[model samples]
Target: MASDTDFYSILGVSRDAGKDEIQRAYRKLAREYHPDVNKDPAAEERFKQISEAYDVLRDPKQRERYDAFGPDFRRVPPDMDPADYARARAGAERRTSSRGDPWGGGTGTWEEWPEGVRFSSGSAEGIDLDDLLGGIFGGRGRRGGPIPGSDQEVEIELSVEDAYHGGSRSLTVEGAGGTRTLNVKIPPGVVNGQRIRLGGQGAQGLGGGAAGDLYLIVRIADHPRYRLDGRDIHVDLPLAAWEGALGASVEITTPGGPATVKVPKGTSTGRQLRLRGRGLPNPKGRPGDLYADVKLMVPHRLTREEERLFEELAGTSKFDPRRRR
Candidate 1:
């Protein structure tokens, strides 16, 4: 049957999508639109829709019923023909509209039947058809069951050095309840957008339900000297003109510690010197490489002796830098 509130469309998944694909889509959207992370007023309502869609589509039985009966699957019988039900419901709606009560509050109709009355033809023993049909036509009241606490998302920024080495740090969070202090342990080699889950750290649940989890979204702060691409590190290597002409070993600073790189002879500007396994440390997988970009530097002011030496070389030397190769 056609449905207005399509759970598959809400989660951005096809009707034939697997459970893992559905879960991945839900997690990605949940991280983006969770109320604690996104401040847009409409995001909260969108989040509710996403959560509701995920909740219903995750269960096999509910998904089957929803696929067959649409949004009112909970109230419709398993064996009922959806097309006939739809036509009957539309007729009831038109009849109610003709009675001048557009909202189905008119008297003397099955839509507004008295309590405990069996409106159906067959015997539905001990079942209140009035309440059942009333709920189907959008006449249900608020539920009084225990509600689980809401899952929350927060950003945690880290320096490149801090991200290289795992450590413990204090985090202060401010929400509707008040300000709270927490000690968070950052894992090593955490890349951007990685989430660290802390169980039972979100808002408290109502009616004795379990509290939700708190997810820390990792954000790596920009560095003055280092640039990160995946686990690889990039840094500028400034060298004197002589150092570029003649090979020299120079010390460079890395997130791990100080390291030395060999500048090859005849090296020019823009040359990248790779130092293997010197980038970010990965505990579980292969580590990354470090790349140093070569830049030739000249002294701002030349000494009188340096000027005389340059003049002599210019006068006698056959080498011409501007000559075409």
Candidate 2:
């Protein structure tokens, strides 16, 4: 029978929680009960229990079945055959003890006990100090040292334009052995701090295990004229004084290409112009919008003839800049 502790209750989250929510809850609890950090005797056991719960709940199909059938739904019936029970018990003991070789073959040496008695292979044998110490803590054997390899991490910075348009880039990474050029593909509309995983590109695994994965974290560079909010791209467009008053078609650069936008007459400095379907791409493969904020630019240095024309125009025109305020 399953224990009384509810998996959802232990994680302090609802059973219907999503994968991200469950992962967040598990991370919180793992950090709190981690054996290395907590230094309590029960912390390892609690962490193991939480890991088991996460393993089941993180999978969508498993979570669905578990939710529908309850915790004991997969348990073996009490009237099972003796051989089946023995096999189940052996499997459980193997997982719990970690005494024998992980592989099926038993070629590894085993500690010798008294002539008449024998415990598990890695268990305490006779009255040896090392065996006694191993049982007290986890049953960790002084096997061969870890395979010689080093893990590495790299961060790449991209402009908002690059993020909007997917492209290939070549980066040079310096490692312990030497520098290597890695050709990477930057996906369109990738957000800042997003990670791309490259399998088998990290440190080589020890004892023929699979290699770790390399994570590439994306960081968007700050733009002087543009700001990004979700899939929307915002830019401050500086316009000439006459352009705002007269209203003209102006060309602007977009991620797709240069396109001309129509400016309405009497446009204010804070007026916003939206270009539909010209922003970043969303997860559902749809494009967003681009917003342009108009700013009027007045000339500081005017020729003598231009100044005389402006003075004459100002006398005839009744324009007050602060009339609205």
* Candidate 1 wrongly placed segments (more than 4 Å): 1-145, 312-325
Task: Please provide TM-scores, in order, for all candidate models, with all chains considered together.
Answer: 0.58, 0.55
Identify the runs in model 2 with alpha carbons over 4 angstroms from their true place.
1-15, 19-153, 172-180
* Whole-model lDDT, model 1: 0.73
What lDDT tens digits, residue by residue, belong to model 1 across residues 210-235? Answer: 56667787778889999887688999
TM-score of 1: 0.58
Which residue pairs clash within candidate 2?
none
Whose lDDT is greatest here? 1
lDDT of each: 0.73, 0.64
Q: Which ten residues in a row have the lowest lDDT in candidate 1?
A: 114-123
RMSD of each: 9.9, 12.0
